[model samples]
Target: MDLNDLFMSCKKGDVNRVKQLVEQKEVELNVRDRWDSTPLYYACLCGHTNVVRYLLKSGARCEANTFDGERCVYGSLTPEIRNILVKDYV
Candidate 1:
């Protein structure tokens, strides 16, 4: 599927839809938008911890050297989310 559906699902914190999209449709969890933001990035920015967790668990990347990774770490809505990015994705 397209990043639109995957990004919307993550942004809305639709965990089930995210799961279905990633699992059944094989959506790219690390797909970036026009601004170089990923599903994991939006999930972190929007405080969608569950969605972030699922994205990571499903193999979303968190490269510290990338633009989206930097934003995901800095723009994270919660400390726990930052910790997840630091402890798991990085």
Candidate 2:
């Protein structure tokens, strides 16, 4: 699939599709959309814990920022996700 599909999968919390795309299909794990939102950003924003963990393990960058200049950690919708992103960097 394409980057849009990857983003959609993350938003939908489809961790399997995300794994397939990132692992087998070899899609860039950190690609951002027009909004400058990466898959990890969407997963965090949507509160997909599994997706967030999977993306983290898959080496998705936590430093990706939104168009508004908010980091993914700041944009995260849940404390768990925020912890994950922060833990990675710190």
Candidate 3:
């Protein structure tokens, strides 16, 4: 599968697709795109709560930073997503 496929799936909140890519195809959960955005970053940016949860549970890293050195949790994340990442940090 294309590496961008995971990011696209998370951006669209397609949890099943994300799962298939990660579980079946063995895609790296923390793979970053050209912009240095991970699937978790996309999931949070798009407000896909379920996708975010699944990514986290699947060992996605909350501590990942964008190319600009900004934390994914500090990006366009919803409060719920911020909470999830914050809780994981602590």
Candidate 4:
């Protein structure tokens, strides 16, 4: 239920843990941590494609103007992820 757990789960690429937290806790998906990064941000930064997809599919925001948002694109490990963000943004 804690946001930290969700963030860690995403960063660790624990898809099941992320799924359980996102489903059971129903916490605000876009809630920023002390680092001003969201669950999706960590997922993207760590190049966890599945985590990023799950977050995006669950309505996570990826605005182009935001630092984290832009960084998500720059930090993504694959073009598929970048395409996902671009397509979603557009």
lDDT of each: 0.85, 0.79, 0.78, 0.84
Please give, for residues 1-90, the per-residue lDDT of candidate 2 as tens digits. 478889999999999999888889568887878877788779988999999899878887655344422577777899987887767642
Q: Candidate 3, overall lDDT? A: 0.78
lDDT of 4 by residue, 1-90 (tens): 588888999999999888887788667899999878788888988888899989888888888788767978987878888888888762
Better of 1 and 4 by lDDT: 1
Clashes of 1: 0
Residue 27 accuracy (lDDT) in model 4: 79
lDDT tens string, model 3, 29-88?
888788877888888889999998898899887653544224667764689878877677
How far residue 36's Cα lies from its native spot in candidate 2, in Å, is 1.3
TM-score of each: 0.89, 0.83, 0.84, 0.85
Which runs of model 4 end up more than 4 angstroms from their true locations? none
Q: Model 2, residue 28: displacement in angstroms?
A: 0.3
User: Global CA lDDT of candidate 2, please?
Assistant: 0.79
Worst 10 residues of 3 by lDDT: 63-72
- What lDDT score goes with residue 6 in model 1? 86
lDDT of 2 at 69: 25
Q: Write the per-residue lDDT of candidate 1 for residues 1-90, one digit (tens) a residue.
A: 577888888889999999998778677776778987788888998999999998888888887777767888999999999998888666
Best by TM-score: 1
Candidate 2, superposed: residue stretches over 4 Å from native: 63-70
